[model samples]
Target chain A: MARVVVDVMPKPEILDPQGKAVTGALQRLGFAGLAVRQGKRFEIEVDGEVTDERLDEIRRAAETLLANTVIETFAVSVETQEQAAAQGQPA
Target chain B: MARVVVDVMPKPEILDPQGKAVTGALQRLGFAGLAVRQGKRFEIEVDGEVTDERLDEIRRAAETLLANTVIETFAVSVETQEQAAAQGQPA
Candidate 1:
């Protein structure tokens, strides 16, 4: 099995009200920052090995369903079980 | 400036209906996998240097505002602009 992480974020040009709200909350909480952009993250646990073809399939999934391509972009990363464990997460 | 990524995910014991919906969508779209879990990702660009104190503050932000501790857990990563650029993202 393999674990894949997909991060879906809005285009920088688009306004992110949720992010802006969090930014405001952070400021009220005494943490100053440049900006905050909120997005979606998907952690997929797949059966079998992760091949190049599978990676392409995952990209398609991101483009077609995981993200709204017109206003959002996504990046995909394959994570090893060991790496997930090191991060204190079960894969 | 530094870009910090906070990934907030539901606890394994908690049910993720959104993830289940996405999983069904993916299978319907002809993509096969074991399971899919969805969560939130925050990309925060902060001013000044990223010190340990600042990292703690980010953690606090994550704990207090970014994640609902009762049902979700979050992980934080500090990314350098160079690293973000390498990943083809603007920091």
Candidate 2:
């Protein structure tokens, strides 16, 4: 199976209410030096023929539906267990 | 510095409009065997002596502000380069 992960985040200038709330909480918790940002992640699992061609389709889907075209920027990744074991380890 | 990441996803029964849209797109893209879900991720970075006690405070912040106490479940992790390198070396 192939998993496509998409992460979407609001532009730095866009006011993120959720992020602001967390920032305030962090400050209250004595983490005076933390910067927080709220964003979105979507996990899509696909079976049968995981190819670069298929990934392009999913990437387009993320851009059109999973992410807001107006104020958010997104990153897309298509991964498999073998791929994970092959390249740089995930953070 | 330490970073905390919180991921939030709707309950299975909850209507995920973003997810639904992605599902539709995937189906159209010929990924008939795939299931898609949409969710949120928040990244927080803090400076000034990180400790176990500080981590507890951040966990609470994630529960309170980073996640909706109602329908979403979240996972928290504290990681650093040294830890990653140690883990990667495979003892």
Candidate 3:
């Protein structure tokens, strides 16, 4: 199976309270000089080969359902076998 | 500035209701043969160069704060310039 990854992140202009809270917590915990932004990751396992057409479909899905276009943006990419192995996932 | 990416995913055996809901929604929307698991992504911007020690520190931060070790697994990686450009993020 091919795995597709869709990442949905808040727009640069948007304020991310969750990220801000984490940043503050990290500083309080003595981890400094770091700025964080939080987002969502979706791993979709497809039953067949990932073709360009399939990628397009996934992209459309990302745009339509995975991301809030008004305040967020999404990127879709296919997870390679090497990456799967590195993550200790079955390839 | 250097960017580090931390991805936190639910344990394989854990129930992912959000992902399951998304999967059902996709099927209802005519997108088929896809199973999804949802997770969290954190983008951290470091003020200085990323050294091995810094990476270890980030890993610690991820383990202590970014992920719930009981039910989530996290991976930390540096975001290369190429990937930033591809994602339309400032490098």
Candidate 4:
């Protein structure tokens, strides 16, 4: 199975309240000099090889359901075997 | 400034209702043969250079505040200039 990763992040111009709260909490806990923006990550397991058409379909899925295009942007990447192994998954 | 990305994901055996819903939704939408697991991604902008000690500190912070170790796992990595440029950010 091939795994694809889709990351959805708020637009740079958008205000991320969740990220702001975490930043404040971190600062209160003495972790300083850090600014954070929180987003979503989706790991998709595909049944077969990832062809260009499959990737395009995944991109469309990301655009339609995974991200709010007006306020967020999404990026899709296929995970390599090495990456999967690094993450402690069976390669 | 340096950017560090922290990804927190649920343990593989854990139930992911959100992901299940999305998977069902996608299948219903005619995107088939795919399974998805959802997680969180944090983009942290550091004030200065990222030294080893700083990386350790961030790891601690991730353990303490960013991830619930009982049910989730986290990984930290520094974003390269090439990745930033690919993402349409000023490198």
Please report the candidate that would top lDDT against the real structure. 4
TM-score of 2: 0.67
Question: Model 2, retained fraction of real contacts?
Answer: 0.60
Residue-by-residue lDDT tens digits, candidate 3, B1-91: 9999999999899999999999999999888988999999999999899999899999999989999888988888899988866665311
Q: How would the docking of model 4 be graded? A: medium
DockQ of all models, two decimals each: 0.55, 0.30, 0.55, 0.55
Higher-TM-score candidate of 1 and 2: 1
Ranking by TM-score: 4, 3, 1, 2
- For candidate 1, the share of real interface contacts preserved is 0.63
Q: Which parts of model 4 are misplaced by more than 4 Å?
A: A89-91, B89-91
A1-91 per-residue lDDT for model 4 (tens digits): 9999998889899999999999999999999999999999899999999999999999999988988888998888889998766665211
lDDT of 3 by residue, A4-78 (tens): 998888888999999999999999999999999999999999989999888888887887788888898777888
Q: Please list the residue runs of candidate 3 whose C-alpha ends up more than 4 Å from where it truly belongs after superposition.
A: A89-91, B89-91
Candidate that would win on TM-score? 4
Worst lDDT run of 10 residues, candidate 4 chain A, spans A82-91
What TM-score should be assigned to candidate 1?
0.92
Summarize candidate 1's per-residue lDDT along A48-89 as a digit string, tens digits. 998998888888888888988788878888998775775454
- Weakest 10 consecutive residues, lDDT, candidate 4 chain B? B82-91
Candidate number that wins on TM-score, 1 or 4: 4
- Measured on C-alpha atoms, candidate 1 has an lDDT of 0.84
lDDT (tens digit, per residue) of candidate 4 on B1-91: 9999888888898898999999999999999999999999999999999999899999999999998888888888899987765655211
Could you tell me the lDDT of residue B17 within candidate 2? 88
